[model samples]
Target: MAQKKIGSVHDLQTILQISQALTAERDLDRLLWLIISACSRLVDADRSSLFIVDQSRDELWTKVAEQTTTIRLPMGSGIAGTVAKEGQTLNIVDAYQDQRFNPIVDHKSGYRTKSVLCMPLINSSGEVVGVIETINKKNGKAFTARDEQLLGALCSHAAIALDNARLLRQDLAHQSLLHELELAHSIQQGLLPQSAPSISGWTFAIYQSPCEQTGGDYHDFIPHAHCQAVDVVVGDVSGHGVSAALLMSTARAFLRALDQDSTRPGQLLEQINHLLVQDMADDRFMTMVVCRLDESGHVRYASAGHEPPIVFRTENGYCDENVETDLLLGMLDGVGYAEYVLPPLNRGDLLVLCTDGVFEAVSPHTGEVWGMERLRELVRKQASVGASALCQKIMESISDYTDHSPQKDDITLLIAEKT
Candidate 1:
């Protein structure tokens, strides 16, 4: 039966249906079939073949809708490839007559070649995902500009579908990865000391953020049975990855052992650093703040190149550095580390501890870190605020400053207040 000619808007009711069906497809392979089928039907071509570019193979593979047989063509080796390489449409009135028309596909399929109207399949990034080739227009007539117009509209829909499929896959993969990360993050949070040690007349909070799905930041407050001392720790490893997260776990295990000892904070950190420096990978290092808080909250602390904790005084809107820190742990062997002291903090004063993610969160526009100065400002502003409120306020500030840019690094926060 001779097909009705697509000569008027009324005749285009089928084309409109084809467009809607193409857009409605979400499965990538099914969408490809719908596209090539619509192109062949609209143009009344004898065959419609899709050749998707395989970058790794440097070939165009026919992934769907084979009219005769499987078709694969070399890049820059045939009419289809040339159309793709040039990013243009080519109507070969006589495919055999063209020097670039490779006869290998026809030879393989045992089909006589006559004519081909081929167009490059482009995606949003403007890269060629594939090519569509329609062969032998109906009634032995040549394909026209109107046929090109119809095919062009179909190709536009096809491009959008292809891009949607690609992005959908990426999002699914990222989501799955985040779920795994969340699990590890939850387990690590479980390891953190819960509710701080209930020492009379003392208060503490831990703030932590992981730059990725998980992070290298660590913090804890351990109570003593015989002494007024309570162990505290804050540490950050050198980088971000599952490997870094593992290293942090090991560091935590080591700290737990040291916390069991009735020893000086300085000696404990040195022993841990000595053990870590001997075997940590070339790129690995950790910064830490270790302190012991007594019943009266007289905090004796030490550092290993970790950032200083900021203490906000209620006497006025002033934030002071509690102690100076040394270099990060695991960077070098036999590095010495030690503890220091801090005067007893009064009720209403707050202590803030963090990893580099705190100071390094950038203003999306300016690309500058939130920095130490601004951090102190937030602490002072929230001096009268509860520990949870202070933590929330700082986090909100970081998010606003970054302008919702995808978090570049893990974020961690810990707050200690005497009430």
Candidate 2:
């Protein structure tokens, strides 16, 4: 049967008014309601719906009609979904007789759906973003060709409005996330030692370089209240970014609270490890080293799978690599850490503690790792300099070796020189 031409000047006016309203509205929910209301009024239908395409899930979703519950259907599964998938207008006089129409919704809601007119809401790029569906014409007749033309015009405006609203929401979410990261970075930085501690007969030098706003590497100097001994700690948490930085902060707090003059370095680390294993996730872990240095140049240190300290003996003109290894923290409970006493440092001997990033930095041009041998040679040559100056020299060497490649990990160095 040929379609009835029921065109009217008032219909054109209604579409123009709806377009103006949609252009001004930015809220997505309100905009969707406006579109659905407009669709029902324009076509004189019993009910109407607007389903937005969710490309990520390969589905079409709509909210409203049932109050809180959202309706989702696979692409090309039903009348509205088929219109969205094909980017075409579907006008069926008898919805039950049509092969593309799914009557499950009618069965569930107990509402008879005799006629359905589904139109694709296409963007300026000719891509269908959604579908405008209207069911059961109020006049006891199928929707005419004039109704389809009016709905198509309204849908064009609705698509543009939806695109703008979605983009605004995405930009706002991105800005909010960036602000949160900035706050997190600030808090992590405040947890670190601000300045080197002042002590006679010892010069301390420290530096930390993070590839991002925050890093997993941590270092601190905690002095004993009763004795002249000072504890130096350097830790590297696995991975980078916010999660690693959070773990680094937690470990720092645990170590500081457990630290005592009577407690050995190994005993302190064991306590911290047990706490971490209980609190942390299975994939996470930390490698750390703790060393206590006295005014008399006597030292006791312990390692938890961390890189051993490089000792520069000024008299012998040799570098002593004597740090014993053990299992890293947060891997398993009941793990034991061993303490090793280094040969007492004579006058002018320097001890260097660092994370793996100090030596494992890769060169972009050469594709080579600046290994331990290069670091040992550099320390031996720069043994005569003060602790602070030697740290600066090593950083310079690392910069030169990588040829200004982007740093992939956190770099931390703590140098203690016996004066």
Q: What do the candidate models score in CA lDDT, each in turn?
A: 0.78, 0.88
List where candidate 1 sits over 4 angstroms from the true fold: 1-20, 37-78, 93-116, 122-130, 134-157, 160-194, 206-216, 224-228, 238-284, 296-299, 308-324, 341-352, 356-419
TM-score of 2: 0.90
Per-residue alpha-carbon lDDT of candidate 2 for residues 1-419, written as tens digits (9 for 90 to 100): 12222346677788999999999998888988988898899889888888999999999999954222578999998888888889989999998899988877777877888988999988888888888888889998999988888888888899999888888888988999889988988988899888888876688999897888789999999898677889989999999888899899999989988997337999988999999999889898999999888988889999999987888888899999785889999998999899999888888999999998988999888788888899889889888987889999999989988987779999999999998
Residue-level lDDT of model 1, residues 43-151, one tens digit each, is: 8898788877888898887767455656677788788889878889998888888998878767877887787899888987899888888998876877888788878
**Best by the TM-score measure:** 2
Cα lDDT for residue 151, candidate 1 = 85
Question: Which one is best on lDDT?
Answer: 2
The lDDT of model 2 is: 0.88
TM-score of 1: 0.62
